[model samples]
Target chain A: METGTVTTANPLNVKAKKESKSKEIARKLLRSWTGVIGFSLIILLLILSIFGEVIAPFDPMDAQLRDRLLPPLTDGHLLGTDQLGRDILSRVIVGARVSVVIGLSTVLLAGLIGTIVGVIAGYYRGWIDIVLMRIVDVQLSFPFILLVLVISAVLGAGLTNIVISLALAGWVIFARVIRSEVLALREKEFITAAIATGVPKLQILVRHILPNIFTPIIILGSLQIGTYIIAEASVSFLGFGVQPPTAAWGNMLDEGKDYIFNSWWLITFPGIAIILTALGVNLFGDWLRDTLDPELKGE
Target chain B: MSDILLEIKDLGIQFNTGKGPIQPIRGVSFSLKSGETLGVVGESGSGKSVTSLAVMGLLPEKKSKIVSGSIHFNDEDITKLSEKQYRKLRGNEMSMIFQEPMTSLNPVFTIGELLSEPLKQHKKMSKKERKEAIINVLKQVGIPRAEQIINEYPHQLSGGMRQRVMISLALLCEPKLLICDEPTTALDVTIQAQILELMKEIKAEKNMSLLFITHDLGVVAEMCDRVVVMYAGEIVEVAEINELFDQPLHPYTQGLIHSRPTNNSRKSALYSIKGQVPRPEEIGIGCTFANRCPHAFEKCLKETPPIFEKGDHLSKCWLQDSKRQAVMK
Candidate 1:
């Protein structure tokens, strides 16, 4: 713009720019203590899920009647023992695998399905839009958890059923969110530019516009991980979740309810585990959403 | 005489709506010979752009349609081409630069990406070749730090840089016909001149025919060799640039010239036309501008004057006959 000193245009020198943008996103992510703390908790749980078997002092399925209902500060049971005589510490640690796997895979499947459905509906529009939206409408009419309950019951209850059920329950959020995003994005001049350049519609979606909306998806996905965990726990507690011997916190709670009055440690510890894991994921998601907002991008 | 590169004859476009359909341009005709510039000047709703867009096949079909038209480019009816074929023609044979450069360039993409897209699309150049072409286009457009700006997003650059980027993108393919729909309107005055200069340079370098659409008569004076002054979706006057400015035929043309402020002049309250542009619903049966014309007579009110040409100039008014009668006397 300042005339005279016009330098040569080099398109390939974009690596520095892309690197800086990524750094900016990372810097923004780390700006808050809450974001860092939430991130650490999620990471810690993920690590435990990955290596819980290697680290658990006693096998997650092992029980000792002699050690049953041991309170905190007892030897052998790190936190305490549940009414089932299973080590509560070991079970809570092992529950991370089910919760993380279900939460992540549900969101992954839902986000993939919903984003495709939404993009196709929004991009092509007209009859496709009407049909897809009508489907969305039909899906929306049912209470989500009830729908999940029916689905899991039909599929016969297991960890996989909970994953499929949670995926069915949550896919609508992505369909709605991404449909609107696509609607807005499709009309921009860049789209026309892309069209002029003969960029395929699918490429435009996956490459150009998808990157722009990923932050919101990540934020929402992270937040929903917590909700999915809680949902999985609820399903398990209702006798519709993991089929025992897995040491999922929800089933632990189901077994612990009998000892709730005399031996509160049984229900208390698993309940706390569920609460902490959900709280951790939700906090991280919220922080991610806040920081990723374009308005808050700079200093 | 130059060869006819883009020939458009009797082009009519309209918009379909709940109220049936509205005819924006009844029938418009124009042509762009190779290496020629045609300045289409008019008030906002004069169908100047609608006509160009119809020729380019870029109409937003939601509320618009080309009910009837034949656009001949390189001795072929472009209107008959499929959307895919039309796209093939757009960036390769004919590229368009839109008025708002900011909106025209994608904010998410780097200028380099935008500049190199057409090169890769039509030219099929490898990355290194495309990179060099992008930088060359940017340098030609007079963007300093073309390399730096190439990596920069649209938001990172100033308005002028964005406009230059738009220009670079347009010229990247070196199309034969550049349909610039008021490309300089959103720029600053100094930047406007710079863009105009850059456009002229590009036009000459590529030997491309340019269809420069604008409402500013001043720009017509500076950039056009021939001019078409439109009023209410009709071509009221067309002539060589010098003759059109010197002996303006249409009352609309006269009004536009008088409306421009001049240096060291009384300005005479800067004459403006008495009425607003006729809404499509309010248009009368005869001459669309009859109600607003100062020299309108009974005949002018009842009849639409056909275009009468003398040499390369044409005037659509009853005054030509009267002037001829006076000359005979």
Candidate 2:
């Protein structure tokens, strides 16, 4: 605004002003495509889990004698009624809540515990590394299923117990991944730089190392979610999951197991739900792994 | 001139593995004068790196260990110091620049963040002081627009730039000694010259002793004030750079000087040593280089040669007698 003022602009004005956002837009579009199918499936389950009660036509617990063994798309039963005359459609749709919750909780809990153990084992690395590694070896030696089942039994079955059992058993994966990452990163100049600068050990782990290893954690976490969902459903199907009449898909699966002989809808419907949900998550994880690591992607 | 920055007496580093205890460096002794640059030149696996790592107390606990050594630093025998004490000195009094700058610096941090890190940790400087220090260090390394560049990450910088950043990090602490471990091997020729010049300038500015470890003879000629040629974990030759280069003493040093690419013609194939440097386990009681030496006589194969001195130039070759006889004939 001042007259006769020779104004020299910032030298990096070209870079700062932004190159044609074409590359960014293209990268985003490319990244979004592979994740779309998985995202839709996840979003659908989340929506169904949230709105199960409000949207179901029948009171999920209501019984109709005549509607028993009704095939899918029959009058009043969109996904068919099970052997108990309970709505199969309502049960599977509501089953989304337990599956989604189990998937999220297991990952969150396991991830938190695993990261802490891994960082400590990796960072200090002396007798600490040796002792921590021994613990990991011992944990791995426990019959994985037996360990989870025992843990679950001791804790007593409910949503919380399932979450606890899963978290305890699943923590080692995150621990191992994060530990290796920290080991490699600890040798790096940034760590030396951190130490040279006198950044505290705790601060180095939390701020420096953890943020860098986040990509692998994300990829592994997504895959682990699929496994957790299947595990939750299996335990529940065995009658150890959500107690019956809770409208859980696994308990519905347990109820339908006996009648699976005469009527196919009970087992088929819930079984299909677990399979489809797990499949979607796995596909999503695959996409993320490929996207995050360009080496894995075919040119 | 006499104040010793580093004095290592009877230094021996051994690696106990499945094979046996591999003694790569045996009874190695040297003193680094304050504000002087000392070069440790050697073939691969000559224990040049191992010696420096041993001095820094940075060798991995899995395999490498100081079997016997007394490392006196600032009048204190620090070889017996604990990890905690060593860690305190590492980025402060004696910082090291590693061989591969690409893998040495963590790729995640901005260059400015990396540069300021030592200041923040050791000094606990305020944010303003940290920023100013980082800018100053970056500028000290001759990086233009260092203020803008400090915010960049390792991968964003070229190999030369990364090495400079490393130098800045090493020099940041105003350490009494800078251990440069093959610092320029990974860079291009032009970058190597620039880095060597930068190192010379910085060492002068800080008046710090430099323990320069390298395999390149040319680099030694340029940056080294005194040269120590190592072979199979022992000092085969030690003297002033010009003294050793002008009148090469050790047979190994003689071979290295002769084998330089410039010494050979365009059509003629370049001279390469006939065999690989022997691994520690494969080495016997005799002179380590005798098996590869063209002038090796029967005595040379059976007994180890002592470090022979003539003026400041030292040589460990049995050729001293046999070559003299051949010359007289």
Candidate 3:
């Protein structure tokens, strides 16, 4: 419905118009200081996750009772040691591996599953829409942590099991978001045109519908990554997520809670990691939403 | 032109709204011969587009139902065909182009990809062959610099160019019939003219039948060989293009032609039709256009009229009845 009068009048200017429009969005995103900081922090966390073990000064699990509860800047421990004398800095850095991996994998799994269901339900409405949406509603209504707790309890504790639990919780969000988008797009003339062309239903879903809805999926996935990471940490803290020795941020916070009045550094460092990662990913997601769809940009 | 390409026999389409069922197209029958262009003209909600969608098998499954109909396309009864069977015929044997060129081509896809889809689906062409064929078709449809424009997306083209791409895409498989539903309704007048010219040329070169649906009588005059004037979903009159324009039958058709603003009528108020098309729910047993018709009588309000054949032309009105004929005689 957007009538680009200038572009339509002079056909030759269309390509240039698109180029400048994208460049303008890119420039605006780059100029936002929060976006830059968020982008940098996310990159830093990714590097740490990939190279954490190589960069850590000491083994994360190595505990020496003799050096237990060491304060900050004691005996070359940059961030000091926990109640078990394991390096706090080493543990947090290595813990990034679990958080980032779980966050990204859960998002990927949820996005794929959700998009397929959403496209099917949205494109072929009536009974399919009713059934799929009702299931989504049921999933959404139940408490997030409650469902995760129950699933993790049944599945037992492990990284993959944790991923599956979170993914199951996560897919509903994507399905709901994408289904609404598909509903609007179904009435668009291009979809009818595609159907008229004799393009198979599956082919139309893949070729026509999926690409158009990819922007929203990417934006939602990026934002959900932060939420899922925090959720993964929460699960791990409850002993239903990653087992203790794996060093997840949630359990690190849990371990530090017992020694909180005494050793503040244990919780302080891991808590910062969650806050910083969440902050960065959230800002970047906001920027992505603005950049992909200009209509969403407040200005 | 003698060969019958498509036939619609007593096509009855009904929609089940929350309130009740409304039969939009009631026992409508028409046919298109090979290489002949048939124009269906009507106002908004006249079921012109719905009829076309019915032919394409693109009607919404849950909302709209073809209650009773048979669509025979090249000897195959498409109404009885399954979705899979329709798929094989679509884009290969018959294709359709819609109004709003900007919205009709997927915005995400480059013109190259959009154009090459039919080839990939129906034709077993390799990548290189497909590219070549796409470029060839684009050029045929009058897209300048087909090589460069092929890589550009729909948002990067003008309305006219996008329409050209649509035409080229529809023509890729050399379909025997092309149904264009108000293909020029969304473009500017000049662009509409260009698109019509392109369609006219392509249609001639391919020797294909065209079912053009539009409300613009001028377009019908320019492009169609025969015109079907419809009111409230029923065909009121059917005649050769020149004959219809010269001696316009059906009060609705006359109203449409007179409403067109001409250069000579700049000082005077543009003529307008009186009442809006009655809603489907309000339409009853009597003639749908009786309230709007300039010459309605006691009988026109009481009973619906059957289509009366007079030589090559057909008109559905009490005036075309046997009693009226007897009185006149």
Candidate 4:
């Protein structure tokens, strides 16, 4: 009996030790070089986006023809001006807000809709699954860019319209990913246990199914943000995304097209901003996927 | 019997596929008296798990349907009960634990949250009351660090620990009926013994009717008061545990007992039953077991056998008929 008590208490101590060791591993992971770089880049981009108005040397829309096409570090314009004489630096700074806002909104709306549809299709799995999955199939069949162009043309170009169209286009991927995940998740013994316990169907979906599929949802969502930022840039470049004078990264790239040869800085700076931000996001998302994966967590 | 806790009569379950309706369980029936632990033992495709699911009203809604049946619990017919009505009884009056303890719990929820769920839904206990109750039950189930373990998620625990948590979850509502479907199949032998011990202790204390389903006959011998032996979706024999071991009536039961590896036979070739269980589509009009039965006769092939009774034991075979037994003697 004494030995039994001692053995039982020892496991508790071991568990406590294991818990603290995991925390240490987490700390060690964040202290790695890639983690520091990725973290800093994301933090820096967020601050610039949120504080764009205060930090911009000039109003992003301000125009002075005399400063037009001036090279970087010329006079007050730190990054010079575009053909419209708008401060390139200010526009790039302000453009981060549009990318982040559109990216986040598109993902959130798409994620919510997809998760609901996927959960229903995966859980109930009869006519509802057939119809919902067929719809997803129909959405996936179309050329994505063509679909976006068609929707943008019908809705007319504006920020809200861009957001709405991207959401519509983006939700299919989320639905497909989440549906596949939930299909596997619903088969787990926990779900049967939940049903046997008489947890309400809705409660089971929310509390059991949703939480179990979150790992995939989060990884997919993080990766999609970077993709959506690029997607928004592409649509705006084609004149079917955010309208002109709004200083979206895509529109900036659009306006810089004519001055590609003479004023290379027009496209160069905004292009770097998009590339760097996308790179940072991708790096961070990849890191998260690896870190959260149980298979990889040991290393 | 007047004291019968649950009665299932003529339970027929069918799964409709693209080809046609495939019946898995045809006319399977049994009754459980109060505080009795009834073991339903069968091979893999014998429909033992399906019977338990039918009782819980948790069969897959799309593919499967209870074709014809009546399930009475405490004198109330539950066959026609709506899902909402079942909810009040489920997890309150009855609950279930399943196999594969490693994957039988939601990965994200802490043990405390999962265990407290039935209490929150059925008992309407306050947060403090629920916590204390949860801790007490965890301790009752022999979890050493109830408070610490409560905060831990399922993945953090070992397989045995998870199963213990599952048993605790099933017992939280003090359910009158507990359906355990191969609950220890996924655990190692040592853990299996421990879980069985825990279950025996708890069942004795609570006096709930346990419907224990397993493929292992040894488990039935150890845990059951009475045992039902199913073959090809039909009950072939039913008897008290000791009676079953003493004189198994049906050929399948006899075959099952013969296949057990006795200590003296360790160096000799083991006895095994011949032929696989026929697929549902392959089953013909006559007795489903006729194709596999060693005692199969012209009548056994030409007609389905009604259950033949002798004293308190029953066997579904022509050989069990008194006239046939008398003639053979």
Candidate 5:
């Protein structure tokens, strides 16, 4: 007995149903306080990063000698001017672009490299697994900061170099996490079915293995963004990232530290910005893990 | 013989583990004729699945090797086929449906995507042609709402529907030989009946040879033309379906037939063949089933029995020997 109604049903109906299901998930996510606050903060940071140039009240690089070290509640400067008499509010907003860019870029680069390495190692196994895993082990054994510093020093200090160095240091975690995920996933019956179906090894890795491990990768990426942001700040503080006049959060923090005692606005404002952004990314990451993880859903 | 689609002669598979090398399949031999359903019946650890995997060229490469024997498909010895050559044959000339339907289909893919994969890999067809072919096969397997079901993921369907999808997948390339390894074991009774019925219809319509592997004798009686009884990695008997049930020659085969619970025997305790199937490492020089056979004697314990043929029925037990039968009497 063939069904008459479903045969004539529009294919667009499936798309509509999928859209509604995602909308329902979004509504459920916003029901929790963590989701609401984390989402709002993430939105705020994204806005600040995108619209920093237009939104800043004064040019971040413009110096106002008379307005130097203006404290909170000042007329011209919102958060206050830094020791260089540059608008702290303007610089912080502009700094969002650098922090977000470096954090996002580092995560993307590292995740791409790590996921590829991990999938290859986990899928082929044998000597490839042993060799790749040994390399990961060697990298992980070194102090993370020292490795980054060495990489940064070799590449020379700049925005791109910092992202590169951070990604090099950061990828080990992803490689480790995804390799284990891929290892477990390779044993799944669908993979065997795919092999039995004559699917090429590369296609199976891309189509079957990659999609299944995406949730973990996304969760790991979001969490790592906070760490990368802090790392950029640390590297910049050491004079190895985002040179002066660009107003990156890390370099801004480096400049503000000298005036930490007297001009509290300098260090305080930048410090608060860094903390808030890191907090936002971390909170969003946690909520994402809870929402995206199939095991944790509906409970 | 000319119509034999696939034949395995003395196939042996050895898995090298850290403990030592263990031979899971030793001297497994059978032939599946064109348009015939050959059932390989065995309990778990009987090397049924391993033998099927070896046929598909899906065995774990680094750990296991084909220690002895040859698998000939359409006159070609597939055991020696390179990986690339096997890839061309797999899903093109032959395909397999696995035991666990729940885990066999990728969860992330839609039914349409899953079905389209084999066509894309082996067949040269335009997108529209592929879709039409997919819907045709899906409907042939008795899946309703073909268009609607295509867009749904594996998790959206029940176990029966997924198994149907898997069957449809295996049939997509129209492979000459279809190996069903316990395809209906995971389903309940009603669903199992429906799947088996569907498979029979498909096999008839396509004239595809089927290597049906299952431990369920009931399934073999319903599905098979001929049956191969494997015990502890060795074939104890091979017979036509009706003859094997009518006059099982080997003691092990007799025990298996008697062990089935019948309508009249339901009230009594079910007859069971005593002792577990021996682990691969535990097997020695004697007949593997000698310890469990009711008629096992000095010869059965000290030496292995060669396959004894009486007409078309073959049994691997000392009891099959005329001299041994006379001595026992």
Candidate 6:
């Protein structure tokens, strides 16, 4: 009925109304305490990742043997120094870049590969479905960490290889979720209507199927970013990720573990940074799932 | 008036199941003239919907195969057309409107987006021209507030409004033939009438041939110039609308007509033909309705009856044989 009155309104007004709807969602998001904290934490991490080198007072890689193992509130070092006397605050600041980059890129690469496999398997079905799903099953049967460790070990250590190995391990979840979504959606009459309308199969997959499955993809991507961040830290701590002498939180933790009994700030700062990033990502993902899920929106 | 827009000859479709291949459609044949509405009346499992899907070239590819027959649309045998060729004709020269309006429109797309698709696919229209055309079609389909409705998603509209949008979608290209598979069965009575009226107005305006598939005999009476009654995947009767209703030759058609509850029969038990329609796999060499036919004889149980023509009316039943009719008289 409101549409009746809005009929006379110009297209610009309609576009404005659409913008307001999203703005309303943003307003609702900020009203919740979890949303506020999670959002702020992510923003803080983003800023740290982008401007870490510029803002860090001391070069993260520079070591001062005389200042080794200094406690918090030392001169020129806010959080103190590591066993190598590297500034803990600067290391933690720069470590955010590695975690965010590895986390975001891994999810992106994994999501792309998985969604294509899923849409193909689901839309075509029969032997194609069986083959792809069996591959997914074989991949999924392995423990998540074991799979990542095995892949990282085989590929050897580096930034790109870690992202690749983690992506290979993480894509199965996305494939499984997206495949099931496509399986359900392909049977809907709208899909048949699209086919009858002469829309090409690829167009149907991209325009119709992909858009419908985007919510799950976004939710899965957000949730997986947290998992990948932790996975990267674990891999890097094992020396299979961003190598030593780098300001990655994982190797920083590895370096500081030796002096943990004497100097607490070394490992404590990096550990807190990893936990905060993961926690923030997970909280934001949960809120996103709740808000975007139409079924849950009734509450 | 005499020009045939579409023709089907002995269309047989088989579905491959785990058990075995079962032929659901067997020797089904019919034709639609350029501006005529042909109603296909049948019950569930009668293969009416399957036949329509075959016509649209939308049948599940790996599962169902067209084992026999040809579908000639506009003088070309569409059954032989490649998928690419079929695409050229589909949603261009011919289009289909499905039964469930609720699920037919993509929920994520706005009405304008849905309508613009067929235009984008088949016609060479610019964005502005397409928008103008979409608004014009929406208005022609009796959708009020067409401009605003175009911006709204499918979920925002009621069932009747969505059905109108679907009609406008089917009409976007001014298709020569429109296949509607029980389009009104899902709507309430009032909405059903409104949709039927809108379709009739559009059909006349466009001079489009309509293949209307429904199990409701009332709809057949109102919308069809000719009717094809299908039972067990085979057409048992084909006749002009008045002739089929007044003198339903096939026992199944008669049973269908008699079973309709009327005020005259308010105090009496409604007449119903006994026995369910045999499934495709259960059909044998004999007449499909032999078990249910009140007038069935030994011959009806032994052999399948061929189509017996009487001027414009055709009936597939042993009872329609001249000798049998004379004996009965």
Best by TM-score: 5
| Top-down lDDT ranking | 6, 5, 3, 4, 2, 1
Off by over 4 Å in 6: A1-8, A30-33, A54-59, A72-79, A262-265, A294-299, B264-275, B294-297
Q: How would you encode candidate 2's per-residue C-alpha lDDT over A145-213 as one tens digit per residue?
A: 667777888888999999999889889888888899889888875565455433566877877888778
DockQ, every prediction: 0.33, 0.29, 0.46, 0.46, 0.54, 0.52
The C-alpha TM-scores of every prediction are 0.90, 0.88, 0.93, 0.93, 0.96, 0.93
Estimate the TM-score for candidate 2.
0.88
TM-score of 5: 0.96
Best of the candidates, DockQ = 5
Worst 10 residues of 3 chain B by lDDT: B147-156
Clashing pairs in 6: none
- CAPRI accuracy category, model 1: acceptable
**Cα lDDT of model 3 overall?**
0.88
Candidate 1 residue-wise lDDT, B141-250, digit = tens: 89987767776678778888888888788788888888888988999899999899988988898898999999888898889889888888778888999998899988
lDDT (tens digit, per residue) of candidate 1 on A177-270: 8888888888877666566555555777876777667766777788878888888888888889897888898888898888789888888888
lDDT of 4 by residue, A1-299 (tens): 01111123257776787789789767865867676676677888899889998989999999988778998999888899999798999999999999999988988988888888888888778888999999999989998777888888899999888888887887888888888888888778888888787788889888888877888888889888888888889899998888888888999999898999989999999899888888878887777787777567556
True contacts kept of each: 0.38, 0.27, 0.75, 0.67, 0.70, 0.76
Estimate every model's Cα lDDT from 0 to 1: 0.80, 0.81, 0.88, 0.87, 0.90, 0.91
How do the residues B195-241 of candidate 3 rate in per-residue lDDT, one tens digit apiece? Answer: 99988998898899999999998899899999988888888999899
Q: Is candidate 3 or candidate 4 better by lDDT?
A: 3
Which digits, one per residue and each the tens of the lDDT, describe model 6 over residues B68-169? 999999899999999999998889999999999999999888898899899999999987788889999999989998887887889899999999999999
| A1-299 per-residue lDDT for model 3 (tens digits) | 22221124346676687789789876987888888888998999999999999999899999988988999899999999998999999999999999999999999998888988898899888798899999999999998888988998999999899999998887999999999999998899998888777789888888898888989999999999999999988888787998878788999998888998988999999999999999999999987887787255435
* Model 4 ranges with Cα > 4 A deviation: A1-37, A57-59, A73-78, A294-299
Interface RMSD of 6: 3.3
Best by lDDT: 6
Interface alpha-carbon RMSD, every candidate: 4.6, 6.2, 6.6, 5.1, 3.3, 3.3
In model 5, what lDDT does residue B122 have?
96
In model 2, which runs have C-alpha deviations exceeding 4 angstroms? Answer: A1-34, A55-70, A82-86, A116-147, A175-209, A294-299, B319-329
Q: How would you encode candidate 4's per-residue C-alpha lDDT over B260-311 as one tens digit per residue?
A: 9889999999898888988777788777888888888888888888998888
